[model samples]
Target: MKSINGKVIWITGASSGIGEALAYELDKKNCKLILSSRKEELLQQVKNNCSHPKNVRILPLDVTNFEAMPQKGREAISFFGHVDVLINNAGISQRSLIMETDFEVYQKLMDVDYLGTVAVTKAILPHFVERKSGHIATVSSLMGMFSSPYRSGYCGAKHALHGFFDSLRMEHEKDGIAVTMVLPGFIATDVAKNALKGDGSAQNKDDDATKNGMPVSELAQKLIKAIEKKKMESYIGRKEILAIYIKRFFPKLLHKIILKSQVR
Candidate 1:
């Protein structure tokens, strides 16, 4: 098992949602954390709420800016001496139809969700390689495995993550680096309200699925457990987890049910 206790972890999207929840959970376990987000003030607030505020350092960063990742990664290493885990959790969701979605919306999705993550991983690769120890964990979605309506762009990005990280895990395992992919079902967060529409505008409203999703804090706890176990891939959430199996074994049936779902 790969224990995170006392490990230096750098988490993107740490200002809100799952990242924020993960911070609070990991803080209780005595893990040193570096929280990154576009908002410095919000990151500071999350740090304050953690068990050991002093142990949490805020590194404000926008993942979409690939060019800045190297400097940011250096800043993180300088702050903690070394980072044991890099959690690529900073991403956006989409609630737009494929045809109606603007080209720029898809571009933005790929930019932030796929390219941004890969950039940060490349930036931190040197640190982990030199140390011969590190973990790369990503927060993908169940949509990465199974498709649904109004999430074409989001699903595409998540699927890209699966491909990219799976290859990363394969190539880097020999380097003593590990990778874990997390697929989560709906957890109560503002992702829906903040989701982009076909016009590249915010949906600005939560859907029924998101409104009734599980609490984020619980998801964070389970995520940490999976990381501790060093599971190559893990799923967290409600009955939606069954979809992965269903999609693989009963594709037609899964398609029928997903069509009936109000995921949008």
Candidate 2:
């Protein structure tokens, strides 16, 4: 297994939820952290909360600003002169029906959730290639593997990540680059409240399923384990994770079950 202790790791979306939880967990592991997000103030707050606050640095970033990512990547690497792992955790969710959602909503989802990730990865690809070592771990939802109502745009964006990252792994395997796709079923976080609505507005509300999902701390532990093991794909969650297998062998039944769950 790969050891992350003492490695310089950069995490996007470090201001809240899963990202924030990871900062604390990784801090405990003695990992050097560079936290990035649009909210610089919140990133600082997360830094202060860490057990090893001195080991953490804050790098504010707007992942949607595609043109700026290359610079950001350079700045991230400069923090410790080299970065060992990058966690692509910056993303927004959706809570709208396809029929009612504006086209711009889909665009925003693609920009932030799909293309944004690609941009960041591309920004650091050259460095990884030159060094012949790196790890790219992304936080993709279970929606990436299967569909769900009211999450059409989200599912689409996440599904695209799998296609792109899988290709990245295949093309860079000889270069000693590692890719791990983290497919989370659900975790207690603000993802639902921050999800976009049909009109491109924040939902500003939490859902039952999300409120009762696995704790963020638990997910962080599992995420670190997956990274250490260099898993190509890691499914983490409660019973919701079964959907992946069910969709594979019992497609129709999975569809019926999802419809009956009324998750939205």
Candidate 3:
């Protein structure tokens, strides 16, 4: 694996779930980190748990605050002089049917899960270009590869990331910018518990699939490997990942199976 020691990496949504796990995983490599989230106190808690707490700077950020990203990005750059890697792991999930879901919920999903990431990346792109080196990693989901029950908006947002980042990779080769689209199947995270319901309220419960999926630490390690390899894209998790291939090679079969599954 490529050594990330002493590299400066910035992670959004650093308070919990995959983001928190990534911080811990990278800390072992002696990386300098900037942890960001809307909750400053929680971010501090994560920083405290890192291998070198003194080296981990906590930056409270809300990716959904599109207008604030330029300033936040500048602050991030100033904190560490420069960022070697930017991990976009901040996103919201949905657990609502398309027809019944509120239009506002869809807007929020696009705003937070899709455009929010675009905003942050655009804010930092100039720095990466000037340095002629950087890695951009986004935490996408299996839902991004194909549609699933009660996740229409969430899937839409993730699918958009695939398009945007793939195009970014196509255009930024000379700039030495690498983009890794990390598509995880399901890791034991609070995503489902905090997922948006049809009315735009938190889902407030866990899904069986997520509860039974790969551990977050395991997912974080796999993600680090992919990022170090500068992989264009990668998938993580157990059986859920196989569904991506099935959907690709046998659309009808995958559709039938999805319809019969207990996703909701």
**Residue pairs with backbone overlap in model 1:** none
- What is the number of residue pairs that collide in model 1? 0
TM-score, one value per model: 0.98, 0.99, 0.98
Evaluation by lDDT, superior candidate among 1 and 2: 2
Kindly list the per-residue Cα lDDT of model 3 for residues 1-264, writing each as its tens digit: 277778999999899999999999999999999998898998988998887997899888888888899999999999879999999998999998888899999999999899999998998999999999999999999888998889999999999999999999989988999999999987899999999999999989998888988999999999999998989889998888999899989999999998998576
Score each candidate by Cα lDDT.
Answer: 0.91, 0.95, 0.91
Query: By lDDT, who's the top model here?
Result: 2
Per-residue lDDT value at 211 in model 2: 97
Worst 10 residues of 1 by lDDT: 1-10
lDDT of 2 by residue, 146-243 (tens): 99999999999999999999999999999999999999988999999999999999999999999999999999999999999999999999999999
- True-structure Cα RMSD, model 1: 0.9
Candidate 2: misplaced stretches above 4 Å? Answer: none
Which residues of candidate 1, in runs, are more than 4 Å off?
none
